[model samples]
Target: MRRIEKNSLGAALMMALLCSCSGRTTSEPFVQSVSLTRPIALNRETSHLYSGIVKAAHEVSLGFKTAGQIARIHVSEGDYVQQGQLLAELDDADYQLAVDALQIQYDQLKDEVERTKQLFNQKSVSANDFEKASAGLRQLGVQLQANRNKLDYTKLYAPTNGYIQTVNFSPAEMVDAGTALFTLLDVSRLEVEVSIPANEYLRRDQFTGFTCRAAGLKNGVQLRLGSITPKADGNQLYHLTLAFAGQPDRRLTAGMNVEVGITVADTTRTGGFGVPPGAVFLDGEVPCVWVFGADSTIERRPVALREMDNEGRVVVIDGLTGGERIVRAGVSALEEGEKVRVVETPSQTNAGGLL
Candidate 1:
């Protein structure tokens, strides 16, 4: 019975040794695979593109200076008019009759004033009598001139070169004085409008140049800064206006859509760097990136961000110098000081690393 018990114990020991070997084989540490990229070096000059719209430099509402019935309208909506060109006319029969009556009275008053002056020279009239006659003649002359001006005001003329956008009244319609008769879009000059964020608004002084691209424009049109609104809108965006540096294309008109490009000069002594946004993660409210070291390990590094560019790359103002390889994929699952294997991009001919 003692010999049988010894054999059973040996069998139990062999089974325990096999289980321990299996455990040892499956206890290896996990090494994560990740992709890496190098941060791009930024230059002192950076360019950004934004959607903008073309607008007329001035929108003018043309109206008559005197109240009258519109006799005729010479121009229609969408018609191009030039400065001093007659656009509309009012019924001027009443104004003309008033001017004729004033002229007749002025002529009679002039004759009386001349005779009184002659009498004063001959000492046949008192000084007060001569003065009264001269004053009456001057008052009548002023009245005649005012009536003539009113007659001229019966016609509406284009104050500037522009295209008529709207005709508010029809022929023979009675319009009050200073009532808008035509809406003119002044195209003598063109402007481009764009909305920018507060960050760009604060750095507006750093903008060095501006250009715009539109449909059918092979080359971009240069622009000059015109004005910026002091207050921000509900979207927290400031309205910026830019005028053409020179004369714009003849085909370009108001209400056309365009893309504006702005070039800004970097004022920082240490230039900024560009990195993919995914590589940057938040660490306790601080922006951080996983920088891969020569030892095949990652170190969490804090960085100062300025703003994202049009290409969606974050501009790093501090913490990274440039040309540093960083983990670009699966950054959230990474831990500090952990060893990782870099994932190599497969060549086009050897896709999936099948070879």
Candidate 2:
């Protein structure tokens, strides 16, 4: 009777183990339905960043034509001046006196020359006498014109319409000829001067290769390959100018540093589906993903991926089609042929909802 009881107990234990195993198998996720799409190609572009400075395309340094003491400044720094507008005046008292004196002397000489010419024509004066008068009158005329020019130089006018960047001289300050009085700049167009490293400059072809790469870049800024200044030294660097897409109304000063990015190249494919970057797995250098196949079965399929964007989505260039389900959320722990239960939930989309 004891032996029979022991046998019955052993049988019960084995049955219990079998029941537990059956229950576990029933609860396992068979296959999770995943929405899939046909593989499409998406072009991705990248860029190289460099630093530069913003400078006015048009700039003028105002200076006096002659040396003199400043009498007045009509415009201050940051003031807008028009072409031919008086910006300042030098002390003109002495200049005016010189001009006035020369004018009087010129008038008197002119009268004498006219009188001498009349006498010579009538034969009343010697030819030598008329010639002497003519010489003196001509000399005086030249002196008078010089004095007028000197007087005009005393008042400074803007050479071009622009904003005053700096005031180099103040009222009563003595300045020599060619000494800067004001710095003016036209902000209608701005240029960014970027210095490219020598090695990168030699690869100038790369700059032009990326024109399509900038299509979707931010700030509506576009770049074009400008003149590359002569290469100098073993460390040759070229200066690249960045032109803005539109004129900026905001004020820009000289020497403002900026970051310049140039696209190099891009690879694109179209009409395919993409998967979350997290869903991609590496199987011995092969790109694979756990996909919920039809008939409630999970299988890991090899796929080709390209970095679609910076937003953590990989373009499935190949190996996937629309209407197929793939494990997106719980893909990391999933194995090949592993059964999965896909909870039907809202699918996550790119932030803009457009791939």
Candidate 3:
């Protein structure tokens, strides 16, 4: 009987140790301590990022002035060309023969006219015959000039310095006069194209100097504002173009994408606030925040954000006015009307505060 009593005592101590190890907590209500800070006003000026495309300053298509078979093409697509450089040529066999025949006829007419003039001096030929021959010669001369111009039209030359963008005709293909046989892009200057909303477009005049950074560039380059379209596009956006202020980056080619930034100052927006990202939480799609009431209680307040500022803080545009205390953290656990205390340090010790 004494041994059984000792075993029961050992069992009781084991139960007590197990209960202590379980780490049970009291089912009691608690208050959470949170740090409070109010939002401040924003700057009068703001900057925005927009998608832009790099474009050639000028693009042109070149073709022959007269129609014929393309006999030779000296430049291909992507070839660099200089002003007055010969790009392509047409078969001049027919044009040459026409010129030769016309020249011979003109010469013959001239000889006849000369002989007629001599005869007229001697009274051997009538005045009517001499005048008719002279008229024929003069008409043939005009025809000769017209054929010569057509012959010169056989060769195509570049009007300006640029790179060939496209070649539309082959050496053996027949094309009409004025057909676009080659496309050239002027790369001496580069421009960036961006679209902006109408409201921003109205204030484009107030935009300060612009800057742009392309995909492969280590730094951004200053850009000069070119022109803003007076008319709006179908999407209600105005297209604006900015030219490179200095020599553009060599790696930046046409059709390349870039991020363009423009700063605008709006005096009407003199008052706003910046809040930490953690202080705001998404209530579905809308952002909401917990504000510490004057009575030390917490209430959820919906807020509107303008944009992310340079310091990584959200610019609160419309929401609570200035001088409203907000909980810095522990927002997810707090409920509406829950009494809380403002703590100097943001820490995890706010889990069990004054009840």
Each model's TM-score?
0.69, 0.61, 0.60
Q: How many backbone clashes does candidate 2 have?
A: 12
Q: Name the better of 2 and 3 by TM-score.
A: 2
The most accurate candidate by lDDT is 1
| lDDT for each candidate structure | 0.91, 0.72, 0.87
**How do all the candidates rank in terms of TM-score, highest first?**
1, 2, 3
The residue ranges of model 1 lying beyond 4 angstroms of the native Cα positions read 1-41, 268-355
- For candidate 3, what's the RMSD? 9.6
> Candidate 2 residues 1-355, lDDT tens each?
9999999999999999999999999997555445433333344445678777767777888888878999999998889888899998889899899989988998988898898899899999999999989999889889888888888888889877778999977899999988989889966566677887876776666564311112233443454554567656455667776666555325444566556777644334344566777677888899887767665567888987765654356778678765666666556666677555555554486554455
Worst 10 residues of 2 by lDDT: 209-218
What's the lDDT for residue 288 in model 3?
Answer: 87
RMSD, model 2, all Cα superposed?
7.7
lDDT of 1: 0.91
